[model samples]
Target: MNYSPELVQFLGSLVAILAVAGLAWWMKLGGAPELSNEKEAQAAASEAMDGFESVETAVDANGRGAILRDRSGCLLLLKQHGNKFAGRLLTHSATGRIDKDKLVVDSGERRFGVVALAIDHAQSWADRINEVRSASDA
Candidate 1:
């Protein structure tokens, strides 16, 4: 068969376009797994925190203690060094105590010794957490 030069160039261009489109499609499909994984993680987190009217967790920068507070105003103060989240309910404490009075939450793992700093920073960070939860719920 004899092919015209113009026809040959057109077909070559068409093939190149299709190849690029196929690659794009492949990449899009490949990203689906990551999306699904993130969805699953979000779902799990939601479920875990479900049934609580409003919940907030604050951890010290050193990861020593965490306070889990529910909508009812009840708070659970957890302390850990090697024990990890084990602590008695602190019934009495001095007012404005900076060392262990407040709860602080940090994103990454680090040794946080003072719960006061965590509590001081909690309001801003918790606002962000609430925003994320709201968006994820939607």
Candidate 2:
């Protein structure tokens, strides 16, 4: 069999491209295991709230963030940032809304920015957090 140098180089480039594409597909960046149950949610919550001693309660569905309640009954929004997770405590004045599949929570003037949760049950999370906020007010 006879092969031209140009053809060999082209084949090599194609193979490299395919390999890279395959690796990216397999990696599933920003993808996490489904948090269908309390146990899985707790695990994600724990990872998000790294310094927290324990996660008393948590709500999550296969995605970016989780609503966590610590041992002190403090509500926190746990979100992924790069290789690690960060958390923002939900204060009494905290407010939230569901825009599409995202739960946007603003911890009033004290907190610097908004915490957006991209999850399956974004509305449910907003509702739950609002319910907690109302209950706390009462």
Tens-place lDDT per residue, model 1, 19-115, is 9989988777433111123233233233444543326555455444445555664333444434223332222221112234443433222343333
Q: What is the C-alpha local distance difference test score of candidate 1? A: 0.43
Best by lDDT: 2
For all the candidates, what are their Cα RMSDs to the real structure? 18.1, 9.1
Q: What TM-score, computed on C-alpha atoms, does each candidate reach?
A: 0.31, 0.48
Superposition TM-score, candidate 1 onto the true structure: 0.31
Q: How far is candidate 1 from the true structure (C-alpha RMSD, Å)?
A: 18.1
Ten-residue stretch with the least lDDT total in model 2:
53-62
Off by over 4 Å in 2: 1-44, 47-63, 69-74, 109-112
Each candidate: what lDDT?
0.43, 0.67
The whole-model C-alpha lDDT of candidate 2 against the native structure comes to 0.67
